[model samples]
Target chain A: MPHDTAAHDTAARDTAARDTALPGAVAPGTAAGPAPVPAAADDGEQSLARLEAGLDALESAAVSDRRPWWRIVLSRLLPPAVALAAIVLVWDVLVWAHVRSGEIMLPGPGDVWNSLVAEWGPSRIGAAVWDSVYRAAIGFTASVLIGTVLGLLIARIAPLRAAVQPLLSGLQNLPSVAWVPIGIIWFGVSPATIYTVVLLGAVPSIAVGLIDGLDRVPPIYLRVGRNLGARGLDSVRFVLIPAALPGYVSGMKQGWAFAWRSLMAAELIAISPQLGPGVGQVMKFAQENLDLPLALGSIIIILIIGIGINQLFFAPLERRLLRTRGLSRS
Target chain B: MTLTIDEAAQARTLTETAVRLTGVTKRFGKQTGTPVLDGIDLAVAPGEFVCLLGASGCGKSTLLNLIAGLDPVSSGSIEVSGGRAALMFQESALFPWLTAAGNIELALRLRGVDKARRRTEAERLLRLVRLEGAAKKRAHELSGGMRQRVALARALAQQAAVLLMDEPFAALDAITRDVLHGELTALWQETGVTVLFVTHNVREAVRLGQRVVMLSSRPGRVAREWRVDIPQPRRIEDADVAELAREITDELHREITRHGRVGVDKGASGHAS
Candidate 1:
């Protein structure tokens, strides 16, 4: 018993001296030292080995099995539906509580629905939607062409990047609504005014998006491309552009939002008989007439259209790009 | 006398040499640090597999880049007889956005192959790498070994006389690496492309190469060379390979130790002790 006690004491002293000699070596338990150190290292190695094995197994399994189709559909569909239902329920409760009595002040869901059915006919609504969509399409298309070229120039040319990069960032943050008055003053409440507003609002983000994407591309890719004899325009077209696609696509999505918002702002502010009524103009007309249900219905329509276009067009493109690049988790 | 004899032999084989470098020196900047490669002279014969073995900070990769024309040599002349050389990195360097076929196709297209031939040629190369089924698979979808094989296929698509590889299979698992070594040897035999492979692993160099050249780091220079006349299909764990690796590793250790002493980095040696 005496010998055992002496050996234990010696071990304790040795541990303490070691701990003092090398600080922070023993992490959690300073009291239990040398004995635990080897054990911890062994444990760490085992875990690392296990983790490596697991990853290998996962990589092999990943080759055969794909993300299930049903899971994709459910993920896309279920949450949005539930959220929409909850919103409708809350809106109904507010209306029942008489928060603001009368259709002019706050319209109930049924009232909005009735007003949409009665006042806004299919043909009239279609024309309004067409007007807004056509204007947005033209503006967004122009923005994309100009923005892409400008972005490529800025990304490649150092002096241009230095000069324009800060201005683009500033413009991206500036609300498109602020451009409506200037646009009207310049174009005098014509279709040109709306186009000008959309261009001003959307171009900055698209150009910036391309620049950001190009900047993030690894230098190794360019080196590899050059080694393969892809020089100048070919390198830019094949290597830089494809590598920068994800960022560019995201920037385009943001640009679309800016374009859509600017078009609406322009339409609302610069309502003209010659310009024809758009969804935004419909809302303006509703507001002037104090028809809250019509206004709410028009807003609902606008929201649905925006969400629909994104889900149908931009989302798929973005998802496909990310999937091919192996950037997506699923 | 030995250097003259070696040069005489090299001169006799000059007509068949796929790649030749004379007095190659690479400096990063004007006077910031010592030159990475100092007076490097290397000659690669047609269809020969040469492994460049070195420790960390060796200019092995830099040497490959110079041969591949990815970077210009600071002072020497490099002659690659076969058009531009194709290079494969430690990483697959495959475009993640491209499918295996697409990746190969791009190389073919860049090499001036017509549109009609790209698909068939890409398929042929994929079959060469024994990855026929994976031609349509995206880089992310394939296993690491498969990706490397695809990368190899893409290199093959270049149809260059020489292939420059920078530790291409170092990232793979032991089993995968072994499998790739076999595939590479077989492909090398079939394709008959001159290969200048760079690696730090002694056994891997001995196993894969007809000749192993060791480079010492810190102003990288050729320290030693061994002609491994070992027969084909040599295993990484073979007795002969292990024996050669042990000898080379000892030499490598000596070189490292010499460098350590010369550098006089007291803190580094102290930590080791």
Candidate 2:
């Protein structure tokens, strides 16, 4: 402890000395004579002192700081696991007390679990899940392409932006299910109808996100970009897009949610036999048969998939982008 | 006519001038706006280091921007000798997305340097700023001084004969700013790039510039010029630099008082309250 105190004293003394000497320390030979050689020598000495200080900063930062890996993992995983356990406990108690209805009416956690594991096989439920996921993926990919183009156009062209920006916002507020009626009238109960609904749900969110992102790009960045000889497309590609990426990624995440919700709504309402029973369709079928456990099982699957895609893809992508800019915690 | 003769003379003088601004006037808008720079004419010679010293709102940065082609002169011409000059701002201005070396390489890339040579050239520039080891560090990770050093290196990579700096070291702490001054002086000697540095710090201007030009605000105009004959590698605290800075500070105060229309202190002398 004495040694530690002594070391701390020395470090404090060095800092105090550096603070006073930094600007006040005149070139060594200037006292005896106003010689340029001595002045240059003095600069060399000051530079060496600064370099040593910088190296010390870097070294200390590296040595004294480290977060344990296990602690980080525990912090990330513990909360969600506890939440799931609590939900299950509450469900079991409700069913045991016969809170609402019989097993046919409100299924217990065990009944739902049984229906998930015992009744639905990979042959039926797996394909249904895949069908829903595939539909969402295709629709989202198309929205990303088309919406990005639309957003960029809206951002750059003032007249078009004025014409379409309010409309885009209006479209985003309109429920995706509302689009199903129009879609059915236009395309019937086909894949195309599902796509139309998904696009209707997703495209405005993505496009509006992009337009907001582009607007939020700092004007200083654009000025520096142009000054560095980045002209026209080069400026947008290098300066504008990278600066706007955080907003863009969030927009994409929102768009994905919209696409998934719209696809589920479309599958439930349209009921296309050609397109294979999706997760939504399975839930609807279960409801028609009064199979509460199966319906609850399908709902759980949908929720899991939604959470999985975000945790696996969008969250990581957003974190990496923000971390590079030092906008997020490591 | 007289205009043609003036143009011929201007063309003749263009060879030696790294930057030439002839009667440059800048107004932000056509409606009820005072001109920022009013008929300003300045010519910087090749390889010379000049500091533009003025108070805040003096349009020093506006002038630098005009010279760098970032903004157009309202009714006059600005010739950079080269196509465009490189400019550095007080805020390090390095792209946060790029690492130290990546920032430098970007400038080189825009200047059409071959892809294979950009890395080595960027390394050399980083070495010149004594930041070679920080090549992989992002702008936020480095210290304030280090970020400015990288920005300087990026400006150097532009390969322009003229460099415009708008208070590029004003944000640093005293120690870091002093260290950067030394480094900048050394770099200027080694590279021989013509530097037009803008700052309000009188001691800094005396310590760094071969020629110091003072500007007055409220529609900025060049007020006075001084040739600094003090020897190179001058410290900010040096006796001669302090003396010159005191003189400039007095003149700057007078310039400020001239703009105060309401507080008409006719007999206050050098001490304006």
Model 2 residue A295 CA deviation (Å) reads 0.8
Q: What digit string (tens of lDDT, one per residue) describes model 1 on residues B1-273?
A: 999999988766655789888999998867556789998888888888999999988899999998998878899899887557999998888898889999999999998999999998887777556566567788888788778888899888988889999999999998778767876875676567889999999999999998999998988999999988777646788999999999999999999887867578754755654
* lDDT score of residue A73 within candidate 2: 79
In model 1, which runs have C-alpha deviations exceeding 4 angstroms? A1-59, A66-71, A101-104, A122-124, B1-14, B265-273
| Candidate 2 second chain TM | 0.91
| Model 1 steric clash pairs | none
lDDT of 1 by residue, A1-330 (tens): 243343345445534544574433222232221222344454322232233333434555635665689998999899999999999999989988889755436779999999888876765666898889988899999999999999999998999889989999999888877877887788788988888889989999999989989999988889888877899999988999899999999999999988998888888898999999799999998889988998999999889878888899999999999988889976
Candidate 1, overall lDDT?
Answer: 0.83
TM-score for candidate 1:
0.85
Clashes of 1: 0
For A1-330, candidate 2 gives per-residue lDDT tens digits of 243243345445544544665443422221222223433434354444455345426532642365798997798889999999999999899889888754445679989988888766777788899889998999999999999999999999999988999999999999888988888899888888899999989999899989988998888888888889999888988899998988899999999999998888888899968878799999998989988999999989989998899999999899888877878866
lDDT of each: 0.83, 0.83
TM-score of chain B of each: 0.91, 0.91
